[model samples]
Target: MKMRSLIATALVAALPGVACAQEVTLSFAHWLPPTHPLQPTGFEPWIESIKEASGGRIAIDIYPAQQLGAAADHYDMARDGIADIAWINPGYQPGRFPLHAIGELPLMMSDAKSGSRAFDAWYRTYAPEEMSDVYYCMTHSHDPGTFHSKEPVRTPADIAGKNVRPAHATMARWVSLMGGASVQVPAPEAREAIAKGAADMITFPWGSIFIFGIDKEVKHHLDTPLYVSSQAIVMNKDMVEGLPDDLRKVIDDHCTPEWTEKVVSGWVDAEAAGRQRMIDEGHTLYKPTAEDLAAWRESAAPLTEEWMASVNKRGIDAQAAYDAYVASLREAGALMGEN
Candidate 1:
């Protein structure tokens, strides 16, 4: 996957008036119910940006919640040209997107804003070529995921023998490190799985529980972020390459740093709202101290070695990429410090 650098300045300026055979229509598919936090929080704003940028030259129709197929299918949908655009989770298709897996490593990100920044930095420095197949709009990770359980989970011993829904493979690894069995349950299934006794714990973004109505069955939440889950937005390769300059500019404009920050801000807002809603309903939030977190991280170190190996087998330089990602974050932090 190889992508040309940003288009020339002159061509970019004249893109809007570039004539087309007829009006173009783009269908973007996602796996959230209409009111899901991510959809309203970020997706809608992105679409509006696209529409406004297109200046009526192109039209977009948003299909939410597998109105077409699951999140796993989104990558393929865009690859096989099923839809013009799709919100995809590389974690959903394990063994295939090992580079993106770095974003899922246990406790890697402190917040969505940091994780999202890390994601962009990871792509720009390590995996941009790998993602060139699609016209990537942006990539972002969850702020942080806490433990939602029927019983309090404060330490490794507490998670022993529990069946937990690990949203991403990295979280699945966290479950293993904590001595818990892993259960495959998407957000929508969290409620049912908890209710049926199929799962005893879950790692998820707080705001999503309300969006998916899972808090009703979840009684307690851990304070520590076990990890963050991440996904990328991509347009069909051909569709993007063929876009007239104006429309391409619109795409670029909608996915900038400013927009990414807004997206993260929205998620944080939703998480705050969800936390309040759960507290209103008597859900208890507990924090495990640094000592407890150290214990958990010790058990989780083996996972990073195994994961790096998994990515290496694919000819991807996992450790180097991870190192570069950390370096980029430090660089970003320093720049922020200067500001």
Candidate 2:
């Protein structure tokens, strides 16, 4: 029996394909807290799918809350191989990815689920050029974000001279356009900025106000799906290219629009629930009137123009790209018509 076992082991080891079937382990790094909804609701299930799909040959270790790198540095971390995969807020490093800024445009989409599907599908075309440093896996957005402030912001003019912490670069630009000053800070540091009065307001998704403890400092909420900030899950380019075919197939299968929608659904539901939580807590929710909405949209119009000019300067067909993005949103029924 012992001789038979030895012969079997020897036979397995001698086969070239069997010898190369060693398990692959990867590091996934993100800046959200371990308890954040994205951790359990989005990333874990996706990770599990990959593990099962690969027959336990691939293992991913998650390093959350900036354990591996800073929030803004995540893209670079993945590119440099500091992390095998990273969750990146592309707008964190403004102007670096001009083509991707289309997703951050104000009032472009109404919800995260369908919007995520549209954004992920549309981005695949541009990712190879805009985010070429890394292997683009999937892209998603939070539920649309609105203003939360110590003081009420009823109109675009209300932002004038105020200090606001924006969700992304496009929001920062919008704040500036409205004559407000932007207190640029990453998500983990947002609560501190608001508490210290460095920022008197924040543009954030409804659910994260409580998740990041920003609700304690802000009492007024704007009832609008003003904008959605885009996020990407990317992998190291060289590592992806060097992977064995079977292992690479596992990764590829998980990086599709289907997987993106599945992962973002939980977060979308959680964030949508925050509106009721705020209401129950007696926080003031300000709904915009038709005129107010029109004014806000007018103020945001230049943002698209700015994006177009900026990307055109980068030698891209900006108009064509914008049209495609809008087409994707319309197809998904996520686009909010001009109001």
Candidate 3:
């Protein structure tokens, strides 16, 4: 009896070390504050899902608010293993990701859920070459974005001479095309820029302005779906490739078109809530008339032509990609306000 007891104690003592040896922990990095909807409503729940799906074999450590690095550096941080995974805004790097600019195009899709699913599907076809250095998890966008400014901007003419904060390269070009000076400010710093008179306007998803506390500084809001910001979550190639089969499958399961939609759908509700909040606050909200929408569309026409021309130079069939995206949006019933 004494000999049996000693053996059982020794086996129990070794169990924790054995479990630690078999478990894997991945680091996830992003720039959003902890209280942002994307964190608590989207990513945190998704992380829990991954942990449950992996049966405790995989664990994830989340670093929010650029704890690992700057927002623009997130892609390379994951690529270089600064974090095993990162939420990256490809548009932040400008021309480096022209293909991704499809999601950033003016008046593209209506809501984040359908748009993100389409983006994930479309980007998968190009991920092999465009995001070759990293393991592409998924691509998503915020709900349609619009101008939040100090003064009412009802037409293209109002944009001229306004110093606007652009969320990405395409928007930057759009600002320049409309004769506005582009003020480069990441979302977190946009409030200060506007407060200091460095930027008179900014383009963002409806809810993000409120989440970032920029709503307090801006008195005018464009009640139009002007554009959306393209974003992705990627993993280090080496880390993905090195994972055991079961663990890799867990990651793969979480990185699907369905998951992309799930992650971004919450933001759609948040956008509506934010817009309503602004209206309740008595901020000047301009709802464009049909003629106003027509003029704005006409003004943005040249940007599409320029984008196609640039992508063609890189040997991409840009028109086909754009056409496919439009088709997907139509099929999903996510055209202008259809959602």
Candidate 4:
């Protein structure tokens, strides 16, 4: 069946001046809810753009809320052709792609737009090597997140002995480093973890707390841009390679750094609104003092050391790569708090 589809695509490419509308359709899978901002704001628009660019030769159908596969399996789904394109969270599979993990570091990104631009550009340089299994499209950022706990977490000491549902692998290590138990779970299951007493707090972006229904489970919120998770859209290599030339070009056009910003823009606004909603609802949103931030910064420094060591073992100049990443974020004015 796959061979016949490839042969038909090849025939279309070989024909002399023959054109067809809506001749190619790709399956795009993601784990976010259908109502998530990324749907209407990001993927839908981008899909339309691709169809328009190809003169209606390309169409992309999105399968949301893990309808195609689990969130952690999206990367492999794209690589193995389970989905032609899949949205993935690199940090979900820890230590697998060390270079990409740098994006998960604490206090790295500020706003989603500039961060998306910076991260997409920077990761392209390494993606050919680090994420070689699939066609690396583009990367986007969530607005940075902080601690939303059942109790106040003003200082690093406050995290002691608590169970936390971390945003990603980096945050899990951060929780462990602060003497908390990292209650490992995906975003969808977060509220259940807290309600069932498996976790007492969570590190998540502002608006997602409500979206995931975790807002009812925890009260005290640390109003800080602690960290942002890195996510990407990738395409199956075979599917892309087998597409007609015009359709392939359309796909390439949508995979740029500029597109990353467009995809993340709606999500950015939603997160900002989520933050304000928490305040309006009378949640105890604590903006950390300069002293408290200093302590948090001091505590997080070791995670970098550990990250550098892990990258170095892979034969890359870890410090240079880390510096380059920071430089990219700085150039984009997206280094957390700049905006």
As for candidate 4, its clashing pairs are: none
Candidate 3 residue spans exceeding 4 A from truth: 1-21, 337-339
Stretches of candidate 1 off by over 4 Å are 1-22, 333-339
Candidate 4 residue-wise lDDT, 1-339, digit = tens: 144445676788678897633266788999999998889998999999998888876777889999988889999999999999999999999999888888888977887788889989988988998989899999988888899999988999999999999988999998888999999888877889999999999998999999888889888999888899989999999888877677788889999999999999999889878888998998998888999999999889998999999999989999898898888998999887665
Better candidate by TM-score, 2 or 3: 2
Taking all chains together, each candidate's TM-score versus the true structure is 0.87, 0.94, 0.93, 0.94
When summed lDDT is taken over every stretch of 10 residues in candidate 3, the lowest stretch is 1-10
What local lDDT does model 4 show for residue 33?
92
Note the Cα lDDT for every prediction shown.
Answer: 0.74, 0.91, 0.85, 0.88
Worst 10 residues of 1 by lDDT: 1-10
Pairs that collide, model 2: none
Query: Residue 9, candidate 4: how far off, in angstroms?
Result: 7.0
By TM-score, is 1 or 3 better? 3
TM-score, cand. 4: 0.94
TM-score quality measure for candidate 3: 0.93
In model 2, the Cα lDDT at residue 101 comes to 85
| Tens digit of per-residue lDDT, candidate 3, span 1-339 | 123434654576588665332466778999988788887778888999998998976778899999999989999999999999899999889878777787888887786788789778878888878889999999988888899999888998999999999999889998898899999977888889999999999998888888888888888988988898989999999988977788789899999999999987886788768888888888889999989999988888887888788778789998997788787777777666556
Cα error, residue 36 of model 3, in Å, equals 0.7
Ranking by lDDT: 2, 4, 3, 1
Clashes of each: 2, 0, 0, 0
Better of 1 and 4 by TM-score: 4
